[model samples]
Target chain A: MEFKNVTVVKKANIYFDGKVVSYTVKFEDGTTKTLGCMQVGDYTFNTGAAEVMEFLSGELSVELPNQKEPLIIHSQATFEVPANSSFTLHVKSIADYCCSYAK
Target chain B: MEFKNVTVVKKANIYFDGKVVSYTVKFEDGTTKTLGCMQVGDYTFNTGAAEVMEFLSGELSVELPNQKEPLIIHSQATFEVPANSSFTLHVKSIADYCCSYAK
Candidate 1:
């Protein structure tokens, strides 16, 4: 589902030479999410909590450490990353996404 | 300066058929700013307060009601809008911007 009734936190965290940028949003049920954009590049990210990422625009090729083949996610698609794991995202274009974190 | 110490709001407010998207950022001094992206289009916006808009990427042609010619702003450039006034932005590409509001 799209975010229609969430409170956006008022801070921005930029990473990797300004290639990836995102903001935090708080849900009514105390869960938090991140919405941001990524430029064309390959990025490695380590997650402490499990995350479900929803793509809003562009395309992404994701490589999980445990998977043999890379997963291709297009616009309006969703992917998940396990907790305490690292994943790599291969961005072909400027991608916009929303990430929901599990509590 | 780019956003580093700001807090991102957890909600998103979409406008104009999702042509423009942005999230709010709160500052340490209690000031608020907005960071977002705009697709290629012509958009007219009315503001209740004064705003300084900084272009992060792409190009923008802005026309204020009092100005005779449109102002061309490039990436990393900034433009200001007066309170209670309206302005039009002619977007050539997907433009990223950061807007700080005067309170």
Candidate 2:
């Protein structure tokens, strides 16, 4: 009998903060990473490599208190599975979730 | 008001897996990541950089049902604050939290 199977993979969270600007990005293969420069607001600055293979990419919403402006996050990724195809994800968090920027 | 100020930083999670063998490591700065070659068991293989600055290092317990062997996680980190001081942390999870090695 022919059969089909499905599986889901999970990952770990690497929190980062700079108080200047930052970013965190994920991949479809479940490999998540983040990196960037924070601005005047308090935000998590995930420390990821400057370069990676081809993978999934998307945006993340960050909400912090006293944040006059929304933090812009950019994550570019590539995966080992894909021979070449790649993309980028840009998400601007509301700063509500991470309110460390509250003054 | 001549007061003291203290703050805490949080991080995000990124799930990863390989199946032959795996590992996950975290730093005091809230930077958590995982990597390794999975064996015959299943565990979350968080994809982190092969190298990091200096920071906090610790152990994690992973307990997965049907997991006969315990997964070993090693994370070595350094910090940008420190000039050079650094160390390493190795954790052996009971395979309970992220149990996917059941085959």
Candidate 3:
């Protein structure tokens, strides 16, 4: 689906030395989301706001805070990360995802 | 700058085995642009519509169609490619760019 009537940042948000990258998308209602891609690698992210990570394609296993085992995600899945927390992701392939930040 | 009141595609345009990736942004004027990132590598792109590649950051050397020598680009630069033509870029570092296609 397409995000309509929003603002898109021109520059990308690069992380893990370019292993993970995203672009900021701002909605009219003052909400924000990031469309990102993750290459095959392991990554850890610290969140300020609570986030919902929705996967569009590819494969990954995520270790969320207080979770016993990593949750495996394939194409079309969603996971939530709490605010002021951290999560680890082991990307099995090239994963494309959208992360919505809670205000 | 940000593209306001636009529509952004959720998925990314992955190229060259994730060496090059972009998100498509559509404007109200029926124009479209791709906000993209390029890792340190050489990439060749064939264009259907004419394109103007505006670099926001990083270093690269571009070989456009009909050009004898490649043009070196630093942090901020712009280059044009003809429609139905191709160009090559040798990225020295991770590069962030906005690619506008001619309507």
Candidate 4:
């Protein structure tokens, strides 16, 4: 199902010198999400709250701090990251993702 | 430069049975843009006005009606499509693009 009621945020954010770009969206229930794209590179991200990431396109290799092996996530797949922890993403290609945060 | 003022649209449009998905953004200048991702497939799109397409990541092979050869667009590249015409996009890999329409 598509999100027909969420409002797209007004501003865009560029991360890691433009290697990653994302826009924000606000839902009716006062929750927010971010839709972003990552370039072909390795980058580290720190999160304050838990995140559920949904892959829109391309492939992504994700490595959590506690995981031994990197998880290969493809299109239409979902992954989870814990709060107060950091994760590394090794992007093989242009990858699009939607990140939903906990309230 | 990033667009910090444009607002993301509330509704999401899914095309070709979810092969392509896009979200709208409204600028302060009264123009609108669409940020979308395309899966691995070849699809056709018809436009009502002139469009400027910018590649965010990955690669795309585009074929216009008047052009005999397909144009390969990579990251940080841009292409134009005429108004009231249809163009075909051959997506070899997952690609991310931003499309702006002429007012």
Compared with the true structure, all predictions reach lDDT values of 0.77, 0.27, 0.92, 0.76
Superposed model 4: Cα runs more than 4 Å off: A1-32, A36-48, A51-103
TM-score of each: 0.59, 0.20, 0.97, 0.58
- Which prediction has the highest DockQ against the true structure? 3
Task: List the candidate numbers ranked by TM-score, top first.
Answer: 3, 1, 4, 2
Off by over 4 Å in 1: A1-5, B1-21, B24-33, B37-79, B83-103
Q: RMSD in angstroms, candidate 1?
A: 6.8
Q: What is the lDDT of residue A2 in candidate 2?
A: 9
Task: Put down candidate 2 lDDT per residue, B14-102, tens digits, no spaces.
Answer: 32221122223333344433322211233333322333322222234333323555433443332221223222222432111221111
Cα deviation of A27, candidate 1, in Å: 1.3
Which digits, one per residue and each the tens of the lDDT, describe model 1 over residues B1-103?
4444446654454666556768777767878888877777899999998999888776779998689999997766788899999999998867777888997
Clashing pairs in 3: none
True contacts kept of each: 0.01, 0.01, 0.90, 0.01
> Of models 2 and 3, which has the larger lDDT?
3
Off by over 4 Å in 2: A1-57, A61-103, B1-56, B61-103
First chain TM-score, candidate 4: 0.92
> What lDDT is reached at residue A83 by model 4?
94
Question: TM-score winner among the candidates?
Answer: 3
lDDT of 4: 0.76
Residue by residue across A1-103, what tens digits does model 3's lDDT show? Answer: 8999999988899998888899999998899999999889999999999999999988889999989999998778998999999999999888899999997
Interface RMSD of each: 7.7, 22.0, 0.9, 7.5
